[model samples]
Target: MKKLLFTSLLLVSSTEAFAKDITVTLEVPSMDCATCPITVEKALERVKGVKEVDVTFENKLAVVIFDDEVTSPDALTKATENAGFPSRIKS
Candidate 1:
């Protein structure tokens, strides 16, 4: 009975879907004034599977959460750069 229960639990747990750890925090060198967040948010929003985006003008940082299955951190960075702002991954 224990073996059966364990097997069932394993299968159920394995079948459940979970969010991936695909968060990226980066600094935008070109972000100087107020409109920076708007630009960053709009650029990131166009990407598929991007669930959240937070941009800090004061700190010049952008943190994004995206689905790995749909997009990648590299792609996210590229998108930000293309939006007329240069960015680097925060260490």
Candidate 2:
């Protein structure tokens, strides 16, 4: 029973790790002020599966790691818009 439980746990963790981390650079045209990135970062943090998020205020970019099963880039973009920083995926 212990072996079976350990195997199950290992499989689950491996599956979670297999989920690819996608990074997106966003064109935040509305980020005209210094505080915009802070708000955007905070808003993105509210999303369900974002493992990490880094915003570049000067370059207008955000690199994010998220679980594909739990969220998507389109959803992230929408969240950015709702946060008052309208953004579009780069490439």
Instruction: Return the top candidate by TM-score.
Output: 2
- Model 1 regions lying over 4 Å from their true place: 1-21
Candidate 1 lDDT by residue in tens digits, 46-87: 989899999989988899988887888788888888998878
lDDT of 2 by residue, 1-91 (tens): 9999999999999997878777666777787777788998988878888989898778878777887878898989999999888888888
Residue 62, model 2, lDDT:
79
What does the lDDT read for residue 79 in candidate 1? 87
Clashing pairs in 1: none
- What candidate 2 gets wrong by more than 4 Å, as runs, is 6-10
What are the clashing pairs of model 2? none
